[model samples]
Target: MTVLKNCRLLPSLTEGYDQPTGDIIIEGKHIQRICPPGTAPTDSGTTIDVKGATVLPGFFDLHAHLMFANQDYNASVLRSQNEYMLDSMEYARVYLKHGYTTIRDCGNDFYVGVSIKNAIERGIIQGARIITSGKIISPIAKGNKSFGTLYEEVDRPEDMMRVCRNEVVHGVDFIKYMITGAVLNESGEPGEMVTTPAEIQAIVEAADSLHTYVAAHCHGTEGIKQAIIHGVRTIEHASYLDDECIELLVKHGCRSSLVPTLSIAFSLFNHFFEGTILPEFMEKAKDACEHVIEGMKMADAAGITIGWGTDFDRENFEKYVGLEFTSRAKTGLPNEAILRQATINSAKIVGLEEKLGTVKCGKYADLAVVDGKPDEDLTVMKKLPLYVLKEGVLVAGTALQQEKSYE
Candidate 1:
């Protein structure tokens, strides 16, 4: 057992915690007790004097491409699987350092995320608890093909199902389907919807039988509505969700993961604002941002569940939660609501609520400790966690004395 005394806990939910300044006793991998400060037992296995730090549940990033970012950025021209894995390892380490104990890897290249998830589970490296959606299913020249790599070509439902089953067999937690075009396509414009409703239904059915959720990468209004009707668990990059699409999502219980990667937007819009970005890219970027803001406002007003996911990093590697929080706030979502999106709500979206995402007893002992209350000043949310605890064992910072290093 481990006892963390003098902590102000922010329990993911907006409701106030039972113990604002109390003690949390963790036994094995679960929180065993939360009591008034002085009531904690001193004879436990480990005792931490938090000095009244704010302890919130570890954050969760619902949509991310794990091995794509570093591969894209670090690769001078081209990269092999072996080279990609090397770069992915660095991302995994940084992911843990950034206070994301758990993440849903939306898509990846070279099947690296599948291997990384295994490596972490087998204690090969220190990384986040990853739920993966291996290669995305989309039409030719549509999905991962845009990256010039990581493409998986499928032409039939059987082919799609076979690949989906193969991904599950390879230990994927979910399947990704690119139902629409991307904003950054090189074809002078984001093309039309690529995957048909029948194809989407096939992918959904395949995942359903395997008991995994499907995350659809879509941008167009019709594509978004189709993905929702077909029952995708979460919609990523909803850059153009019209009222009809929003209503369908709500009517069908669809959730959205808003990836407001303003950094990328700013990158694409650099020319318009500072006359640096290419003029053509500026219009595309402006349209994407405008649609994204409109979609976010619609989602927020409709009371649909939403979470943070940024298609920011190369290889869709991990990112700091603080930056994600700040970027999401620009989408018109309140900072406090965004916090829940990062934690409990994100957890629920990815089907990991039972294991991670909150400070409740019986949940994983994933904790993020900061110097101040995140509930107040969300800007300081990513201040290097003073300490990180996973499964009741301190894993970073001063907590390292009790941590088991994977290195």
Candidate 2:
């Protein structure tokens, strides 16, 4: 058993943030009890005094590509599969050190994600809990082939089911379908729709049969609408969402939540605006940045569930993850709401809400303790977590070593 004494709990749907000082008791991997400070049972156990640090549920990134090492798309294609897998282990450590306890990798090449996840589960690697889509399914095109192993190409709608089943056979947690082009694809434009609604529906049906969900990589308004109508579980990078698309999302019960990777757009814009990035990529970045902010504002107003994602590669992971908070703040969301987007909302996006989101009793004891109050100063997260606990074990930061108790 482990006891975390004297910590300030973040507000959740069930409990107020300022309710009172408390202690969290952990047995095995789950939280055993939460009670007022000094009221916990005094028994033989490992106790860590948090010294009144502010504690929040561990952060989650719903949309990520763990194998990509940098921003150069072409370079990613040429890199060897072994190299990508090796680099990803380091990337996982960086995320955990920064307070993200869980991540859903949107896509990867050569089934590296599956291997990495299995390694972590077996205790061979110390990293964030990973949920991955083995590889992305897209239409056969010159542009898609340029990505090499990153995408699995299918020419017909019927092929969608076959490829989805293949991904499940390889042990994927979900399916990823390309409904529209990407910002980094020079031969393809982001606003152009690629996968038809029928194709999307086929993929959804295949995933449903396997008891999993599909996440669509959509940017154009039409593609976004089609994905919602076809029951895609999450729409990644909905940069061109308009009024019609917003209405369809809300009317569909918002079951298909939105994970707006505003950090990628802003990151590209900063580089392109300053002439550091290529002009072609810069033009696409400018358009994406402008449209995504508008879409996010509309979605927020319509009560759509919005989650957080950075779409960052290993080289930029630590630098960019926290910026999602500021990007959403620019959309007029309060600090507390933005924090929840990274925590609770993201948990729901990945279908782990009941076990992972809040720091409540009976949930997994995944948490980050910060030195400052995040409710007031959102930037405090830019600093690494003061302490991190995954499954009630001290994975990072400072904690006292267990000492033998003697009477």
Candidate 3:
């Protein structure tokens, strides 16, 4: 048993916890009790004094490509398989150390995400809890030689169903399907619809049968509406969402949430030069960056659920993940709302709300203790956590000393 004492707890936006400063008792992997500071039973368990740091639920990233390196699509493909896997594991540690305790890998090539997920579960590595969508499913375009190994390409509804089932059989936590072209796909435009409604529905149905959900990679307003209409669980990178698309999202009860990956667009537009990325791609990235913030404002106004996602690779992971807080703040979202998106809202997106995302009793003891109040200034998250805990075990920080007295 372990006890964290004298920490300020962030109130849950979804489930409220009244106390501001408290002691959290962890029995095994779950939080057993939470009480005012100095009130926890002190007879036997170890205690660590947090010294008034603000404690929050461990952060979650709804859309991440864990196996992809931060290189151009062509260059990323040339990496050896072993190098890719090792880098993925290293990236996992990077994310965890930065305060994200859980991540949902949107897509990956060669089932590397599944392998990494299994390794983490088996205690072979120290990293974030990973939920993986084995490989992305997309429509095969004829003569599209630029298509890499990242996708399982299919055209027919029946083919979509087959791939969905295969991914489920391979132990995927969810299924990811492309409803439109990607910014990085050289053969198509980002806003162009690539899959038919029937195909998307088939994929959704297949995932539903196995009790999992589908996350659609949609950038255009038309594709966003199609995905919502067909029951996709979350719309990723809703870059061009408009009023009608926002209405469809709200009407559908946001069982299909929106995950606007502003970080990718922001990274591409500001950090890269003309020749580093295709000029057309850079142009689209600029457009996406503007449209995403506008869409976020509209979605917030319409009360549509929005979750945090970076869609970034290893090289930009540290630089971009926390920048999401600043980006959304530009959309006029309150810092508290942004915190909820990263914690509770994201947990709901991946269907892990009850077990994760809040610092209440009975939830998993995954949390980050920051040196300042993030509820007021989210930029504080850009700093390494003062203390980080996953399943009640200290994974980062030097907060605890062997002989430090709790009193």
Candidate 4:
């Protein structure tokens, strides 16, 4: 048993605990009870006073690529495969340290993600609760392999079910398909639809047969509409979303969500004139950067279910990982609503709402402690959390900052 004493609760992010200050009791991996401050028996368990700092449920990232060796496209492919595994493990630990206790890793090769997820479950590795996808499924286009690629190649729609079944057999939790080209791929056009409607149907059908859902990497307006019409559950990086796309999401009744990735766009704008970026890559990056935030604003306005994601890579991880908070705040939405995207909304997206999103009893004891109230100032998230706990085990601490900056 463990008791978190004198903790300030964020009402917006909590349920079952309504008091402004209270103590949370933990038994094994679940929050056992909530009582008024100092009312619980402190007889036999460890007790930690959080010194009145605010405690919130740990955050989530519905879209994260956990196995990249570096931020560069070429480096991710050219680096030694052994080194990639090491880096990916370290990335998981570091991300947990940043207060994200749950993540759905978008893709990796060799089933590395599923392997590490099993490792974490076995207590051999310290990291988040990982839900992962197998190798990216993409068409045999130059964009999928301009330099070198980790994607599993396919051409005809007939091959989709077989490829998806192979990934499921290898232990992936879900299917990730490329509905449109990526900006970082040198030979690809970012907003152009590359996968046909038949391909989408095939992948979705395959995933449904396996009792899972499909998450698509989409950026173009037309492709976004196609994905919604075809029953894609989660849309990653809907950077070009428009009115018709919003209408389709509302009309479908399928509860499809928009996961806008603001980190990539913010990173592009941050490093636009660095001179190391290629000209073609810069052009596509510019297009995605220009419209993603506005797209998020538009989708939010239409009562669309907007979830949280930060398409972070190694290079910009530190600089822009938490930029999603400030970026969503720019949509003129309340700070509380923006915070919910990373918590409850994301939980609903992954179908884990009752188990993970709030600071309530009977839920897993996954949480983060910070000095400031994140509800009032979302930028406070940029700092590494003061204390992070995953399933009642304290995983990260020891970093303290009197001052921190975006630079």
Q: For model 4, give the 10-residue run with minimal summed lDDT.
A: 398-407
Off by over 4 Å in 1: 11-17, 69-77, 142-149, 188-191, 255-283, 314-321, 398-407
Local error of candidate 2 at residue 97 (angstroms): 0.6
For candidate 4, the lDDT comes to 0.82
Error of 2 at 350 (Å): 2.2
Residue pairs with backbone overlap in model 1: 65-316, 67-315, 68-314, 68-315, 69-314, 69-315, 69-316, 271-276, 271-277
RMSD of 3: 2.6
Clashing pairs in 4: none
Q: Model 3, 26: alpha-carbon shift in Å?
A: 1.6
Cα lDDT tens digits for candidate 1, 1-407: 78888988764441224646788889898887778898899874768788888887887766666664432332422667777677666666666666778777777776778888889889878887777777766678632444545556676776767878888887878888777766555443442577788888888888888888788877777877777887887877777878897778767755544443444554454442344223556677778776777777788788877776755564323333466665566766666677777788777776677877778767788988777766777777656677788777676754455554322
- Provide the TM-score for each candidate, comma-separated: 0.86, 0.92, 0.93, 0.94
Model 2 weakest 10-residue run by lDDT: 398-407
Number of clashing residue pairs, candidate 3: 0
Q: Which lDDT tens digits does candidate 3 get at residues 10-62?
A: 77542445878888888989889888899987778777778898888898888
> lDDT of all predictions, in order shown?
0.69, 0.81, 0.82, 0.82
Instruction: Please state every model's RMSD to the true fold in angstroms.
Output: 3.8, 3.0, 2.6, 3.5
